[model samples]
Target chain A: MTASTQMIEEGTALEVDGLVKRFGDLTAVDGVSLTVRAGECLGLLGPNGAGKSTLIRSMVGRVRQDSGRVTVMGKAAGSTEARMALGWVPQELSIYPRITCRENLGSFGRYYGLKGQTLKDAIAWCLHWAALEEKQDDVAKTLSGGMKRRLNMAAGMLHRPKVVLFDEPTVGVDPQSRNRIFEMIEALRDAGTAIVYTTHYMEEAERLCDRIAIIDHGKIIAEGTNEELVEKTFGRRSQVLARFDGETAAIEAWAGRHGGRVKGETAEFTIEQAGEIAPLLDDATKAGLELEDLTLRRPNLESVFLHLTGRELRD
Target chain B: MIALKRDRGALVLSFVLPLAFFSIFAVIFGRQGGGTPTVKLIVVDQDQSQASAALVKGLQSESSLVVMMKPEAKSKSAPAPADYTAATAEAAVKAGDAPVALIIPAGFGQHPIAFGPDAGGSTLELLNDQSDTIAPQIVVGLLQKAAITSMPSAMADEGMKYADKYVGGFTPAQKAKVDEELDALRKAEADGKTGAGSGDSGNGNSGNGSAGAGIVAVNVRAVVGENKKSPMISFYAAAIGVMFLMFTASGSAGALLDEAESGTLERVLSTRVTMTKLLAGKLVFNTGLAFVQLTAMFLWGWSAFKLDFFSHLPGFAVMGLCTAFAVAAFGMLLASACQTRAQLGALSTLVILIMSSVGGSMFPRFLMPESMQKAGLLTINAWAIDGFTKVFWRDLPVTDLWPQVAVLLGVGVVLFLIARRVARRWEFS
Candidate 1:
């Protein structure tokens, strides 16, 4: 079979090559490049205004880049074949609020040219996949916040596209609802569907995505598996966590002087050797600080993410 | 206050709508174009006599009446059109050429005045369109005035003949006095001081629409809409139907703004559908909705009002579909031009209300001054209402609806094209 006819969830499902999109003086997406493989979930991590949504929009063919190439399932971006193969769940709740979940799915499916029995079956399958079978007949707005998010996602993939881009699918959702979304993504990956997930929640990226890419100012600054990124950023190193009893300002000053960061009551520092803890304690004691408890742990995706991206993700 | 101040759309709608409506009404009623509309009266003089000729000249002299003997020539070099006969004059009234027609019989000069209240023989026939209530009354009142003031010799001779039949014969002295009075009247008429110059008496309707005339035996006939249960039923059906159709279409078209706000437009565009296809789909849906609305409105008109709707089906269908297409395209244009629901609501209300008021939906265009009537032609409401009036009121055939059809279809095409162009903003980011 030719590449399009194959429709197999193997190899490269989507690719963006040297994409550049400028809006007047601001470059929204600049020279962004990546490959999303089938049966794998790629997490996109970015702080506010970091061009994550723009890059995803460009990949979904909702945006035209000033200079770039984007291919979906071996077809050029914005082509009929590419549009048919790609699914985009927008950052906003884009589903029709006045319509039933099934109807919303049916409307989107029809846009993709599904019809009759085929459309009905696609809607049914989407309901099951979104874990919304029981609420299929309910209007989308009447659903819970989490249910609305799932319906939005379900409408995007109603046609069973080989590649799907989920942009902040779990935004404003509770923890329980977010876990449900994680399960949904996991199920899709198990079924060999290619996924590009975007979120500000670092733990979601760690839990759902097989690989993570961090974009900042319209460029991909980092990309790898969670462990790979942490190792690459700070190789063979560990983070030391200590809770201190002292004035908040003094502890923060001490943490900042030692090339460490204070998060709430705890001060954290990365060290290559355990012996470095002795000097850290010695400095804390000299500063008239008392350590309540301490723990040694490896640096995580959050640390690596902030180390490269600067501002807080939610900001 | 702050929100209203910041929302420019609402602000404009609030201040501009009332002012615009007021201005439209002022222009229509304030006599800015002219004080009173001149009545168009067709004159057919079968009587080739001095008295009938004088009467024609007299009616022509009135500033408030436009008396036409024949249709205008197509061009300056074209042959003069034939004068209207009794048959053609009546047909003109039926076809809405002139609201009232005066047909002087062949022997009207011999018996111009009827001293008796109900005297018969060689009477004048006044053909009228009942829909224009004021025109017929004005014609009737002025016709009698012309017969009395214009022909002094005919009135004298008729009075003598009636006296000779009823009373004893007139004396020589009486005869001599009457002859001297006739001479003086003839001299005045010869010097152009008689006829229309006798008086500028006809400057308004005769205060009543009913046909009541004196000094001449006259038969009044409503040549059009005489059989309908009520006048203005079919008129209001078309008039109000088209006005509401405009409002409904604009509201329906505003659905695009709603979808855009909700982000469904972007999401749908990301699918296999292109912008053109999306707009085309909306156009079709809006057109269908508008057509259905028009059908329902007319059907309601038929059931409630005693309008003769069944016989005019073909003409209604032609006008209805064309009007529907135009209004639907109009809605699309409004939607495409506006960026938000608030803007669409404000803009559509302002525009549709102004168009309706100016286009004769609010009142008869004939009641307005000539210039305002011409301006009314620029509105879709005017064209659609005119077409329906031809079908239901004038009973014109479907073939006669070509002008309205051509204009409405053309407007629809142009508006739809403009809407398609404006909708390109939503195609991509």
Candidate 2:
């Protein structure tokens, strides 16, 4: 194995130490620190305005932190060597719309000082990786939304950097395209590339992330594997979700009396075992509540996010 | 309409554009500060006689003419510069320091007027810049009136001398003839006269010695813009072309704002490309685009307006490149100063239009008031048009373009540096 490849395989590909970023009086990232190793995907899960984007931006060298340090491949962030080793796919569709997909990749590859055969090979690999071989020469503006998003991702990764930050890359894409993106990311992860993925979707984190960091108000409140987060927040417990057809105030009062959260049309309760759901339903029936629906499921990332922040994942 | 009302940029372009245009047009074409455009006239009184002195004094008395005998003093208490000679006066007109110059030849006051068989008098030479067609006519007409009104003794003495040489060589006889002619003119005027005085009101070369045909002979020579196949073609090309080039440059530079909004700028910064390098690339692209726009304009002028483009290619290229660089830098500054595309649109339009109007694009700076003409020097368009004028109209060699080239390149560098400073916000956070 090549020495550079070996080093990347065994080293910390990305590291952030006490990164503090502030805008006016609002601290967007408050003394946050994390590390991503090779062959691992770290997903940042948060609700809206939870500082997930700010943290990712700081790591990518797009945001200048007021304090602390970020290093890629053991070099300082925003330095020439570090920049060459880092790749950022912003949440916004950042590719040039007037140019074709191949041209966009060529332009970005040139920015990274790639040329000739190397640039051509990088373009080809990115096209194939993004499943955009057929639309390689099509103008980005004319492409479908998912294709454009894929091209945006491909442009940032043309140099094959050791660390890649994908900021909400699957936003606004259809199901099939999201699946395609997931497959592309999985391939990158299997190639031993350290990746930071941020999304509001709970399932995406559950399926792809080796570890998940939950951020709220510029601080990481909980971080672990999906099972670990759910276990940490709600141990040995399953959630009881019941929809009762009754007066809104009466249902809210009954759920409150039973120590359940009435969110929208459903009442949620954290039970240690599945057997506890029968008593809750029986209590609901005795309170003159007509049960419309009920679900017994293990607690998940969404449940953990809710239990920790008292807000929906999409709020 | 509602959208337009809400968008300040569109609102400014809609109402403020017309108002700005009107104000500039009024300041240029209408009366300004209750004063007329003062013509700059350099006077060289070689004869130094009574008639010459009186004529100089009369021209100085004219509020519409700024008559200068020598260049301005360097300091408040410094020794005055030498008075201009005939050669220096002609050079001043050619150098565009003044539109017209009057050089009273030697012995002009000896026989200022000639109306005999030998109407031999030293002609007062009026050297003019052909770029300003009106200044020569105004100078010539004013010269005749000033000579008649300011130097009546010189006119009569010459008339008497002419009569003595032609008729009887007697003062009494000459005086009697002049009185008889005056009585006859009075009678003709009292009878509602028509064509009873003179003819050939232009040039006054008749030597008829009649009223309105002029009393003094003046030689009018165009010291600049004399050999042009067409008048003001190069001036128009440079003027109008530079104005639109600014628009093209600013609009092209607005792409930076686009990339910033779309997040491509952020992504690009994450790569090895720094903000300085990105702005440099954009400057080169914008400069080339402006040069192409200027070339197309001149090529069209060459084909249609008989612009002397082929012979002045070297000067044109130098001036064109410098002007494009300066304007591109200006665009970059505007783009970096503004936060959004709408702000850029409004600000660039207002600034470029104002610059164009004041910089000799809408009208020649020579016709503006002296203060406005001096103000024209502050804009890139003025320097560019001046350089192009020297090349195509004055037929000057490329070496003469150093002043303009220096200003434009310096302006470009300074503006680019400022733009780079202003663009730091996009570099991080």
**True interface contacts reproduced, per candidate:** 0.90, 1.00
lDDT of 2 by residue, B113-158 (tens): 6553247766777888888877776667666666665565566667
Model 1 Cα shift for residue A193 (angstroms): 1.7
Error of 2 at B363 (Å): 0.5
List clashing residue pairs in candidate 1: none
- Quote the lDDT for B330 in model 1: 94
Docking class of 2: high
Q: DockQ score of candidate 1?
A: 0.77
TM-scores of the candidates in the order shown = 0.93, 0.90
For A1-315, candidate 1 gives per-residue lDDT tens digits of 776445344588988899999989999888999988898899999888888887888887878789988899889888999999899999899988998988889899999999999999998898998999999889888999999999999999878888999988988998898888889889988998899999888888888899999899988999999999999998999989999999989899989989998877889889999999999999999988999999998888888887787666676
Best by TM-score: 1
Residues A230-312, model 2: lDDT tens digits: 88988898898999899888789888987888988799988887777788888888889999998888888889999999998
C-alpha DockQ for predicted model 2: 0.83
Candidate 2 Cα errors over 4 Å, as ranges = A1-10, B32-36, B76-78, B115-118, B161-213
Model 1 lDDT per residue over B241-282, tens place: 899999898998898898899888988988999888888888
Candidate-wise lDDT, in order: 0.86, 0.85
